[model samples]
Target: MTMLILFELPQVMMMMMRMGMLMMMTTTMMMRRMLLLLLLLLLSLLLLIMSQ
Candidate 1:
């Protein structure tokens, strides 16, 4: 019904927005961690190559 939808729409929209923000935050954090890990690995590889 229109009344039920009207009442529920704002709450549903808020929930979706919150979820989207959380997902974006988590993915960005994961990406940063992955980049750091890759950088560390690359540095270690360079060090190993230089040591030889």
Candidate 2:
């Protein structure tokens, strides 16, 4: 049983690492989209102010 667990431990660790990487990728994508939206909003506001 000890040997079995030792073999499984590496697989579990690898799975956890993969999950973490995926989560980080998703969060970064969301942050990039939010930044783009904010930039667009700022640009539109500036344009409106200039037009006024």
Candidate 3:
């Protein structure tokens, strides 16, 4: 049992690492989407001002 647990340790660690990386990627994607939205809003505001 101990040997099996020891052998599986690396797999568990890898899974944890993958989960952490996926979380980081999702957060970054959210940030980028927010930034893009802000940019679009700014562009629309500028267009409205120009039309005035």
Model 1 quality (TM-score): 0.93
Please, what is the whole-model Cα lDDT of each candidate in the order they appear? 1.00, 1.00, 1.00
**Every candidate's CA RMSD:** 0.7, 0.4, 1.5
Candidate 3 stretches with Cα past 4 Å from truth are 1-5
* Residue-by-residue lDDT tens digits, candidate 3, 2-50: 9999999999999999999999999999999999999999999999999
> What lDDT score is found at residue 9 in candidate 3?
100
Q: How displaced is residue 32 in candidate 1, in Å?
A: 0.5
lDDT tens per residue, model 1, 1-52:
9999999999999999999999999999999999999999999999999999
Top model number, TM-score: 2
Model 1 misplaced stretches (Cα beyond 4 Å): none
Q: Write the per-residue lDDT of candidate 2 for residues 1-52, one digit (tens) a residue.
A: 9999999999999999999999999999999999999999999999999999
Clashes by residue pair, model 1: none
Q: Model 3 — TM-score against the truth? A: 0.76
